[model samples]
Target: MIRKGSQILMEVLQEEGVETIFGYPGGVVIDIYDQLAKTDIRHILVRHEQGAVHAADGYARASGKVGVCLVTSGPGATNTVTGIASAYMDSIPLVVITGQVPTHLIGNDAFQEVDIVGITRPCTKHNYLVSSTAELARTVKEAFYLARSGRPGPVLVDIPKDVSNSEAEYRQLKDVKLKSYNPTYQPNIKQLRKVVELIRSAERPVVFAGGGVILSQASQELTEFARKTQIPVTTSLMGLGAFPGSDPLWLGMLGMHGTYRANMSIGACDLLVSIGVRFDDRVTGKTDVFAAQAKIVHIDIDPTSIRKNIPVAIPVVGDCKISLSQLNRLIDEIDLTDVPRKRQDWLGQIERWKGTNPLAYKQCDLIKPQFVVEKLYELTRGEAIITTEVGQNQMWAAQYYHFDRPGHFITSGGLGCMGFGLPAAIGAQVACPDKLVVDIAGDASIQMNIQEMATAVENCLPVKIVILNNNYLGMVRQWQELFYDKRYACTYMNHSPNFVKLAEAYGAVGLKATKPQEVESVLAEGLSLPQPVIMEFEVDKEENVYPMVPAGAPITEMLLA
Candidate 1:
């Protein structure tokens, strides 16, 4: 018996429990698409290759599964680069399958041919160019394994067109071993002891959780640990909802735009327990001064990330959920109820600084971005799944939106890629059909993925898109305003398309709101639509998100505008 490589690929995916795939069909990968059509696995046909990859990423982030994407070579594979890089930066598990020209056409400048392996080398955890049918099953299995394993990231498999058509005996290789790839989930006893000692001995202890908590499905463990110890917890931007934001012990995001209480708490803690967070510059601010007074205990699945940014007093390399559970069990017997409150007075003093001076805009004739977010929150009560594009809209969404559930807010936090909103909303809608799915995007970012409205209308997905129509690459403009004396060079956009017309063209409902009074009604109408809806808000151009921490400043040193 013989099997096509595409068949083998699909089998491997089924074995890995991939129920959905996001992708576009092209000449090089038509055979795979043919096989895909015959399978039970759901395939989302995106308008653009980039949208397909981001949609997969969103699916992975929202569902905590290994996202799968498929595409052809050359432009198709290249279009997925941004999305791959984005997932890599955020440590999301993604397996991308790209079709290349036939092996015989190598280096001939063949049509639709590109070296996807070379292009994705830096972005992917590992990539394989399958020249032989024998390697297809193992490579795909390894790709999935590497993708979802410790320190998860995107992995690429570039299969040639001929290879997809080639036949090979079906060999089910379970327990395939790779010598160079080893992921350990077990915590070191000595390191765990040191971390426990720190937790027991410290007067002021705080747990800084990151997206890793959600990635590891460790929220339960994280909350239990915090509750048992009565320790304060703070989260990074990507860490929102890792612990209930409304919980008494949980502090919201801690960064330049983070809540003042969260920032102050991180700065003032004597012992900082960082779980599943990489200490990104946004979270750390100035490395030298960031949690300068605190002894850090860094726990993560990726060993390389342990001391990459912040010096660790104790490094626990293991899965966040596993490590936190062990620590919680070991420290249950320690008595810390008598420890004097080291930062009680300091917290009182910082309360004035901890005031929630969130992003604000002047009374607007035009609907403002902040108002838009607030109204959306009011309508949905923050229960809906929210995705955001890059730039000012992303910041505004993060700044104004409050999430009550884990994995409700999905944004490109690490790579901060523009044009991420619409497709991500599509994926979220597909994942949870009952939840209200919205994409909060800037005019610029929205335009980049505007074509995805077709996917929504075609699928009748009922995704609500709120475009912050500032008519500028608003974030870059902010940087120019502050750093470059407001030159506003290429940041400005002009002569925009009537988004309503575009939506109508795509067979979706379209609405526009210029005034604040029109916002709630428009949002209500959009949400009620059975099919997809695009609402463009003519937002105030002058509105700016405040309390920004410049790129390298400590999270404590925020620029309040």
Candidate 2:
């Protein structure tokens, strides 16, 4: 059957089970938008292109599916760069389609046309510029395939305007075979055996899990393995919910703002079994001294990431779930009667470290950001899907809110992008309408994409925005205070909008808490509301996130709070 390119695009999206897309229409994408309107797929009209991509990213993270977003050419396409980079850094699967000028005007500096494919090359996993309607369906299929496969990341497809208006016979591409790409799902048994041997012999072994554990859905296997081996576990920021936070074996998060026990354990452990982590600079404070005492066994689907940052004693290239499953089976075969006894001294040391400097903040007259996060966690019973913007708010949420399951906590861990939480919350809410979704945002970060409040209001999404209004770029200000000797830079956000009025103006409920006592009531009321809300708490402006490891310092050397 003959079909227009736009029609084929819509049909292929539906075929791929894309029920919702976050996008905006412009001159170049009018035909596509027109066809999209005729279909059953829900389109979220975001105020900005960045918001659209962030929303899609949030949706993908929450739903564990390839997120889809569309935008017009030139500036509209350029605006999505930050969000795309964020997704790329975090390895989020996303298919971003951008409209373009006709094929004839390809290199003539056409209006509403920029070389999007070229612009996004460095960040995107792959990209394409479709010149003909005949290849539209295939390109889309390949884009979706590339986006979701092998260390998932964003893939862009630029569709020329004429192609959408052109006609071609439509046929759904079922089998997509890319000769160059094939992900190893099965782990090498010898390496698994080696890991098991290490587990058996090492007196102090720590299972350091990362976002890849959650991405590969290996939380169950990880939990079981850690429990059976009696190995304490510590996670990267992105790996927050990969293991149960409330578990006795959990060592909380490990990094610059990581817990005292977690960092100390990583520094002192004899064996470090790293699963699905990139070993970013934030996690590994000094390359030379990071996990210096430990023999590292690194397992990741992306072979390039194995030895890219830190040298590994054992590099296992395979999917995280598969590798963990194999390790679990191998572990079951070993003599494990003495595992608990072997780990007793190590666990005792960790307990002492935990007791010595546990995560704590004083309850003062002024509202404390940590206290607000604690109350939110309590009120929601740690059940709410918590998304966070970058900076102090992100750190506080990570420290205070205990996540017991995967996908419960979402944040821009790698890119550390500001203005991510609110739109992400909207996307998460849309993906899971029945679940309570909250964006734990900072006052400054929240304003970055605050326009998305209208998106939530229009969609009737009951996402709650908890703004820790510290009235400054809290993270940077903290650094300036500590390192620069109180040379207060341009970090102060002297003028900001009245958040309550801002929410009300966007047709959503607005609440504020000035005193520390009002924090609980505001949270409770905001959570109880059926509509979208922005609950702002005027928090301590100069408050800082502690357990700091100065740049280039060893992870063990920390400036305590």
Candidate 3:
């Protein structure tokens, strides 16, 4: 059948099972928007192009589907760079569609024209510039295929305005075959045997899981492997929900701000089975001293990431779920009867570490940020889909609120973007309308994308916004207090807007809790509301996250509060 490039694009989106798209309309892509209006697919009109990408990212993470976003040329395309970088760093699958100037106007400094493909080349997994309407269908098919395949990352498809206006034969391309690209999903049997041998021989074994486990949907396999081997499990920030936080074998997050037991265990373990993790700087701390005592066995689908950070004893290159399933099957054949008894001493030591320096904050008359997170967790019964803006609020949410399942706790772990939470929560709520979605944000960070409250209100998404109002850029202030002789330069947010009134202005419910006594009541009221809400809590300005490892220091070397 013959169709316009714009119509073909919409049909391809429908073929890809895209129920919604987060985007901003512009002059170049007006044709595409006109076509979109006729489709059943929902388009979330965001305040900023960056929010569109972030909302798509959140939708992808929460729904375990590839996120789709669209924007016009020049600044519209440029604005998505930050969000694209964030998604790239974390391996989120996204297909960003950007409009381009007409083919005839190309390379002549046409109005609203920019080399977005070049700009996003470094950040995206792959990118394309569709030159004609004939290649549009194939290019889009390849774009989505590339976005979700291998080590999933964002992919951009820049369509010229003239292409969308032109007609073409509409062909639904299925089963994209790229001979150059094929991720190894099956693990080598010899490597599995070696890993099994390490598990059986080692008395102190620790299973370190990362975001890859969650991305691969291998949480069940990871949990089962850890349980069957009787090994203690710890995860990177992105790996929060891969293992149930309430499980006996589970240790809290491991890294700079990780729990004492988790940090100490990583440093002291004899065998470290790291899976689906890149051993990022935040998690490794001083790489020289990190896991010095452990003989590491790294398992990841990305071969380059296996030994890039820290040298590994056994490197298995395969998908997380596939590798874990094989490991489970191999272990089933092994003599693992004595595993628990052999690791008693190791488990006991971990318990002692947990008991001595448990994650805690002093109870005070002023509202504590940690207290707010804990209360929010309790009120929600740890079932809410939590997204977070980077800073003290993100760390506090990671530490206090335990996640028992995958896709529940979504945060920008790699890029540490500040304005991520609100838009992400908006997308997550859109993906899971029946679920309670909350954005744990800081006073300073919340303002970054506060305009998204209007998007939520307009969509009737009941996303809860919990702002830890500390009156400062809490993380930077903490670093300054510790290293810069308390010269809090430009960190104090003294002239911040009244968040309650801000939310009200956006046509959303607004609530505030000034004192400790008002925290729970305000939270209850805000949470119970059936509309978007901004619940701001006035917290202690000087409070810092505990068990923080200084930069370049070993993970074990923590500055406890």
- The numbered model that scores best in lDDT is 3
Candidate 1 matches the true fold with a TM-score of 0.96
| Preferred candidate (TM-score higher): 1 or 3 | 3
Summed over model 2, clashes come to 0
Measured against the true structure, the TM-scores of the candidates, in listed sequence, are: 0.96, 0.99, 0.99
lDDT against the true structure, each candidate: 0.86, 0.94, 0.95
Query: What 10-residue stretch in candidate 2 is worst by lDDT?
Result: 546-555
lDDT per residue, candidate 3, 95-193, as tens digits?
999999999998999889899999999999999999999999998998889888778999999999999999999878878888898988788889989
* Residue 211 alpha-carbon offset, candidate 1, angstroms: 1.5
lDDT of 2 at 313: 99
lDDT of 2: 0.94
